[model samples]
Target: MATTSCDVAIVGAGLGGCFLAMLLRRRGQNVVVIEQGPSIPSAGADFLKPPGLRVLARHGLADLVGRHGLRRDHIRYYHDGDPIQDCRFPDGGFLIRPYRELVELIYTCCAMEGVEFWFGAEIGDIAVGGGGVEELTLADGRRLRAGVVVGADGTRSL
Candidate 1:
């Protein structure tokens, strides 16, 4: 068993987690991302709306993600074979990219930023103190202590 420490421990390798890790790393924070899966998540939101795109653009990743992504400006909703509502997107609409592709792109960026990722890592226990997470123990007897712990592990996070 080995013990480690970081400035931040993110408990997920999904898009949000990876993106956050990259941002924090760029700001000189020591970050470690743990994922139960063997790799970046394969499923996620396929649409990158305007606001979301804006955020990526600010981070200089808009061109990378939009390079090969499909763009759409409007969406039509139907119910019972009847036209319901039509929604139009502004500012070049949104991007349609596969979930895996999107996550992979961000993961690559995180890697380039030197963010550490632990794949197939399962949390066995969480030690809490002073109303905050004190440490994390992995199933394989690895330990991680971080100043901040983030649970971006999605809807079913531990």
Candidate 2:
């Protein structure tokens, strides 16, 4: 088939993938995001946590986060039907959302920002070069060449 090239090639559309795509696109860089799975929705839970909170704040998503995030107060540690410790949050809180939803939102933002997406494309082999990534062979026999390749395919990624 046809071969494509990009400044950056992201393997998965997970949190890091999407955020990186957004950042690069904002800087006027061409990026190709390849996903082996279908895009899902994004829930704003990670935005409410500590590190992610700071990160989202930098991205200007903190306000939206407070509106849609969950506040986790305490956790009860159980030891075989016995309560071991009850952890409490004094000033800090945690938030979480479904993983599928997060992926969906990322994909949506990528689309709006004109990031090229290759869904259902399973990567077979990869070649790295001095400049950057040389080539990627997909399961469908399609070849993708790029100056940079990022492995955001998550756990169990090839």
Candidate 3:
């Protein structure tokens, strides 16, 4: 059996996982992305709606959003069929961008940067060593080792 090693192991193929994988690879780290799901679709309504926008902002992605997003100047609020509030943003706006496009871009960058990716592979168990995870056992019974493991498996992740 052949075993593979990496400096970073990313679990998940969601937006965050893909982006982080590309970013880390750009920084010259050997990265591996393990995804339970298939690849991100090329066409979808995935965009930085309210929740995603907040997450992006907190991660210092506001500038990126601004550069790659559609911005709106005003936000309208209605309550019971009546206009309640109209807020104006002086320096910010509703940022909109296709989530699939961003993911595709990141995935391409990851590929170009040599971030190894495995799809349809679910992490079954994690072996912890020292201060971080040492290896991950996949559903296919393959053991992969890494210096750092990132659990971007989302909310329900264990």
Whose TM-score is greatest here?
A: 1
- TM-scores for every predicted model: 0.96, 0.80, 0.74
Candidate 1 Cα errors over 4 Å, as ranges? none
Which RMSD values do the candidates have, in order?
Answer: 1.1, 3.0, 4.4
Q: Is candidate 1 or candidate 3 better by TM-score?
A: 1
lDDT of 3 by residue, 58-149 (tens): 75555665586787767688999899999765545566677776677667767877989998887788888788787888878888999888
Per-candidate local distance difference test:
0.95, 0.74, 0.76
What's the lDDT of the predicted structure labeled candidate 1?
0.95
Each candidate structure's count of clashing pairs:
0, 4, 1
- Reference-based TM-score, model 2: 0.80
Q: What is the Å distance of residue 41 in model 3 from its true position?
A: 7.1
Tens digit per residue, CA lDDT, model 1, 1-158: 76899999999999999999999999999999999999898987999999999999999999999999999999899999999999999879999999899999999999988999999999999999988999999999999999999999978788
Give the per-residue lDDT of model 2 (tens digit) for 106-149: 56777899999888888888877786669998989888888778
Clashing pairs in 3: 46-99
Model 3, stretches more than 4 Å misplaced?
Answer: 41-69, 77-87
